[model samples]
Target chain A: MAALSWLEWNPTSFNINNPWTWSPGSDKKVCFVTTGATAPFTALIESVLKPSSIEALRNQGYTHLLIQYGTAKDVFSSCAGAAQCNTRKDSRREALTIDGIDFFPEGLKTQFKLVQQSKGLVISHAGSGSILEALRYQVPLLVVPNTGLLDNHQEELAVAMERSNYLVRGDVKDLAPAIQKSEDFKDKMTQFPPITSGGHRETKSFADIMDETMGFLD
Target chain B: MPSPPPLSALYSLSFLLALLTTLLVAASLRLLAILPTTHTSAPLAAARRKHPHATRLLIVLGSGGHTHEMLYLLRALDPAKYTHRTYVVGAGDAFSAQRAVEFEREVEGRERERARARGDGDGDGDIEKRKPKTEMETETQAQRDQPTPPRTLRTGPEAYNIATIPRARHIHQPLLTTPLTALSTLLYSFPPLLSSPPLLPAQPPQTPYEAAAADLPDLILTNGPATGVLVVLAALVLKFFDVRGAQSRGMCKTVYVESFARVRTLSLSGRCLVWVVDRFVVQWEELEGRGGRAEFWGVLV
Candidate 1:
């Protein structure tokens, strides 16, 4: 196979007017929240838990409300039935919920793309990963730790990020205000380096990585 | 008949037990279905490359994170070689679909302009190639009025197909239902590969080399998310049937990439799929060989 050029944007496969260039803090377009891999997110699936919290967020003017739920994916397989409780019938906006609680929001691409495309706010558990990803994208964030989890370490991570003023840490009980405060943090996200899953060297270009991966095929 | 324990009832009971044993024996014998198709990692991949046709790659785009990482890998893939590609996500994962649509739109936009440029550059050749297929497909679908869009250069065959399969498990579902849900997911992910022949496209290419787009998945690439597990499993099951042609020639090769998030451990899907997947690549060097069949492939996010 010939070496494939990642930069060879054959015009046929490239989008000319990329929408991801939206200015930061432009709008609370998408409020993306996740509780990590396990689902149902404690009170999230049961009793239509936190309907008011979601409402508070909606009231905060997020048009595309994308929330990732844990454990309780079946209940809201489609966004139309998210929260089991009636999501307000607003023709103007949409609420999309994905079950990735145990690995939920697992829509790795869209989540990032959404973050990139709009002033999407990320509300997630305070895992270093969740925090780093949101920050790397320069999205404003809110971190809520699940103390019920085996790792109480997220508490420390949240506290530190909170101290940095990079994000707001909130309890489920106070989700609305926390989301509102995320505005204060979005500007601070530029302070950190882009999250690097690879080692400290210069980041590998898509071309180089493509060659190496395709080499495995050869 | 109830007056005494009928001797005939005892005989009938024994007969039922004997029939049950026979069924169990036959079921065990059917396990032999797996032997013919099972493949070792290295040879299977070798066999795939050995084939002349363009490789078909089914990339299972797990929700959110997996979708992003997989797209990165997908963009890196050689479209010239992997002619036919399927981007599948879990059922009800509109977000994954939304992302895929976004990617496809970009690709389509790119195609639209390139087709125009190609029309300007090699107008006659482009039209001559697309004319027959467009006409035939339009006739087949009975849409004569719609002008044929300039076909994306098949580089090999059909460009891309996107699909969705049911998820293995839902949040907070009962444990007893898990087995059934998983089976349905497996059913959804594959099975079609069994029914459909290699998809060569509308044009009757003179050679399989020209027919690259018409192939079934020669390779399956998955990162994580439970839905991916079904795709990998479906490949294995399809291979077991060795369902004729290139598929029977060998099973589809699968490459399971551990998410970049896993510095020390594998994700659940990664862990579950590791043993079965043909080539398991990890981002963190430290995880190399930590899980059997996995290798460190440097950072690939």
Candidate 2:
């Protein structure tokens, strides 16, 4: 059975051999990606984000796609070394890694480019830093919030962002539908004026009150 | 018998001595009775008037018996002027069913009787005959209406109600243990201390006022010190001396309804004694003393 499954599998792995080789296409589609480090990845992957979503998208005639595995190494490892290509194994799923992406360190690059020369939507686990980055890029964002973390603060943040029309939010169960509806989702993004930083000034009035009380005691 | 030693002279001397002794005893009794006992009436009255339209007035008492007295007083008040809100706080489960229920039933029954009495206006003979039948009907109705009495006597807004103050169920347990423990501790610890006579400081003799002042700290600590060791000491002392009369320290409040016309005179007589018991008798007197009606509403502690 194992040999038969391997014969049916065909894996195509991409390698980033040189920097500046891949440039972003004019389509301007991007995805900001994160998976909550503290959340249950097994449940998210198996139960919520059913592996059928990626296969369905590929069958729909979309060639270029970006998958950001985030910092959840256990979840990323769970997707590696399968007998059948693109088919996840319950036993050896913990060793999976993204095939074509460069594992660059933070602050090394502010932008990302693809070898396929295609602009695509950004999909990420709901994290504030990732959301802010997507917003700065002016790309339509699809955020899947980790409900298992921190009293569901991410869910609240997702709702607030939805109200502002900055991102589209969904749970892992609805991730495939969310990805398919990304084109229709772009019209809902609200336009906000750019904001400047560093305008706050501090006053020493509280210090004066403390000094006066001390002086009275003296 | 030598003419009985001049009977008239002997009789006069004996009568004179008897009269002198009687006068001295009367004078001493008067002095004891008039020792200028302080009253809390003025402060309490002022507090009541200041919050006349209080919407809810919680009369928290330690037991069912005190709650009964408070209910009686509230019923006597002009209901129109102040809709009374009363609660009995600290009654035990047994007393809650027995005394508290009985008191409430009686108060309600009396109100019904008073309502009936107002309509029954006839000759003395008619009133006498009709009154007994009316009272009997009220008793029967009360029994039927209140098959089982509630544990709490609450009168206020349905949302916010106060529970009565709780009376100590274990009142005697503490009394029994306190003196025994004190005596045992002293007995156990005293042997070694006898070697140093000058180590402990001498306690000064205190006047009654000073003693009472000293007791205030303990009173504050215990919250209800009157019912504890103090009551035990008082009872023992009274029993030893074989003293009786008005031995109760009456906690009375006299509310001088300035606009007396607003008050129901008939209701007032049953609950409150109308006689003025001297202004000086009250702890804090308020008349026109403070020069303002709003400012000197009443004294409250």
Candidate 3:
């Protein structure tokens, strides 16, 4: 077997006070949000941009809010204006820069890295792809399922993942509570791609399954 | 004998119905025998030793979410073992195809780094002849076209190829025309399933690698995709007829992984293929045995 170069970030060992970490604000705390890539969860985008959610982020001492809004540019722009207006009026809240991205074809690698470096949070739609990618960065994740879709599987997946402590499930109608939970959830969240389950059942990787299916001795 | 009452009148309606029922029953029995039961993870070392030269693996990449999970699932894919990789993508899915190439390059790059770390002297001449050519190549043209430094490891362009098949159903396509499109997708699936294209065009495979590349894949891996369902069906058809010794030679063994998003219920494609594929794996514990065969191995992606 050849050695693999997968970069794994352990949140437990990650230091939040690393001064060398790159960010606009030296001590910035960021909260990144990703709506679904293809369909674009309008409700999630709208919910995250609501002033309440923004206030929750501010309460957590977050310095930046970045949203991957997908195709909901109109919805994002409309809600973002009012949310920014409310934030600007509050003198007590420190400067929180809000940003939006329509889409990133190559994925959110840069955005996730930014959040990881800042010891920030990721709020994402409950699509498996986004959740899987975000969790790999070892950031606190809050997953919101698009309830409008007919299939309830996304909701089920979020529930199961949350139960396992992999993420916190957020509601599309209100994301503030989940956002508030992110502060404490950061330290206790379970690892992504868990190495084992309950200690009794043997776990096999997808690679192992492939070799076994092919009858490969190794 | 007046052609036995013109043949149409010879058999009664009930008699014809009986014959049809008998055929259907026989087919059901055959299907039950062909479809694998819950497969144990223990490797069949004896079977593997019989065909030790080369192994070909076919991977089906679907739309965005499916493609994303498929790549992650194959992150640990070993090129040295599965010498030949044929990636099947739906027509017009350039994203998936591009990702496949990127994944291959990433693997090659990783192995090259390992060689450098091991203090194997890195030079064009030294790397070129590092390992004996795994495949017997008679084509001087292909050898010239090969770009990646060879001797480092068994990976890069020569080890893998990408194949494209027509989409089973396009979004917004009318339901009335779906079956027709699906039939076409099923028909197109056979060529890739039979064998990957020869490494170089218009040439028969000369080396062991090329021979395996042009032969039926040892395994077919798929997750949730409409096209995947059609491809699996095509493989089943080939096995049903024992085409080119597909069944006898232990080829076209399929393993379907239910999407990680599917925690409690199977997707439409998962439900469709659950009964037929060789192995059905799910990520969540709750869905471990839904179809009486779904194996849970924790979260793969």
Candidate 4:
């Protein structure tokens, strides 16, 4: 009945650098983290999750931090500047740098081990692909819908996920409360079914028009 | 001749007079039928008065009789909003474009006078008179005094500077004259000949707009489906009647207002209207949907 069992159905390991990465920790609590150039999640993580707020949560004995860095553009370039600033600020949360690995690679057993050692939390931009990955791993998600791009699509997705009781939708203005409620949020993630479509149905539906227009016209 | 005041002659005279009166009535009705009844005369005159200085306006001429309606609409527009830089394309004689150029020249002259008045600071000497050694004047002097250097001068017309003449240049070229459409020029020029009184006179065509308004059709044909039908009908009628001087009139303009109206009406999923109240944000999806529609019809701020 547990949502974590769904990960076994599709046993595809994920690349750590991807916006979605989840693994079982030593405490057996699933943790995942996402950081991409997507405005909503990035804004939620960087702007909303203030260092002071993170430290306050850290004081409550939360140790692991799964950080997703720039999936929207070139990850290294986008996050390198911000990573330097975070280091200068001496933020309390540990930064796990993941870049380049899109999906789970062959020789990443040690990385999984490290992930299992810390009972970290998963954070993700409201990309349906990333959300599906997180759900497959049965990792509780802290969803930050990117309002800047995708217009209202991400907001709709995030609200739907929250309603399904699979994730907690974090507001940009108050990410601390969402983070503090992460334990309760993990309890809530168990209720929803795994996402089946992966957000390609609408695009597939529109693809038929392409063949009729372009193939015939060209 | 020995004239007799007979009853038969008197009866014939009265009958002829009655027939003449009926003929006059029929002729008037025919004239009225041919003339467009949708004449916004007062509105057009008001628009012209309001924008008397507007000599240039952007025009989109399509293939139908829409151009006629467009001109009517243009005339309806407060002329002050446009400089009347009119460009007519599609299927009509080049008369309107020619006339537009003349109108532009007149409007430009008026504009120059207005500009001169504004530039003449506080009733002082004219700005042109004040700026003695202007760039143009210096260039003119240099050109006038400079010797013609004989080394490989360009074979085309020589450039000259004349301060007395206006600096503005108004150029008009047939749209169909381009290399791609040059072959079709003959076909395009055929429509004007069939329309009521040729739109322009056969003199050194001094721009079509310079031709008397009475000579031009009341409408301008645009490139649209409906107007295209009208043009075909008018052409056929003219040919059947062997009429030489009539022209069709209709004009049209495409605007972006329709798209705005569409957005307001369609409220699909994944969209909710959000409103800000003081510092708090509230999401009222239903109200937002309705508001979006309302905003379309509301006057643009």
Assess every candidate by TM-score.
Answer: 0.51, 0.29, 0.84, 0.28
Off by over 4 Å in 4: A1-31, A36-41, A71-119, A194-218, B1-301
Candidate 2, after superposition: displacement of residue A164 in Å? 1.8
Residue lDDT tens for model 1, B46-118: 4223222354556778766678777765554445445566678777777677777677666555555565434
Residue A215 lDDT (model 1): 40
Q: Which regions of candidate 3 fall more than 4 Å away from where they truly are?
A: A1-25, A196-198, B1-29, B38-46, B50-52, B119-152
Q: Which tens-of-lDDT digit does each residue in B188-256 have in candidate 4? A: 433342222222446442433223221322222222222222333333344334354432222111121
Candidate 3 chain A minimal-lDDT segment of 10 residues: A1-10
Encode model 3's per-residue lDDT on A1-218: one tens digit a residue.
00011123233332333432465646878788898766888898889888888888888888888887866789988988888888889888676777777665567787898889888889998888888899888888999988899946788888889999999998888888988887899889888878754756888899988877776664
Which candidate tops DockQ?
Answer: 3
DockQ of each: 0.06, 0.00, 0.44, 0.01
What DockQ class does candidate 4 belong to? Answer: incorrect
RMSD of each: 15.3, 33.6, 9.1, 27.2
Report RMSD for candidate 3.
9.1
Candidate 1 structure quality by residue, lDDT tens digits, A1-218: 01122223244332313432345566536666666653335443332235666676666666555545544455435442554335545555555332222232223455656765776677777665566666667667777777667834567657655664667888765576776676656665535442334555545433343333334333
Instruction: Indicate which candidate wins on lDDT.
Output: 3
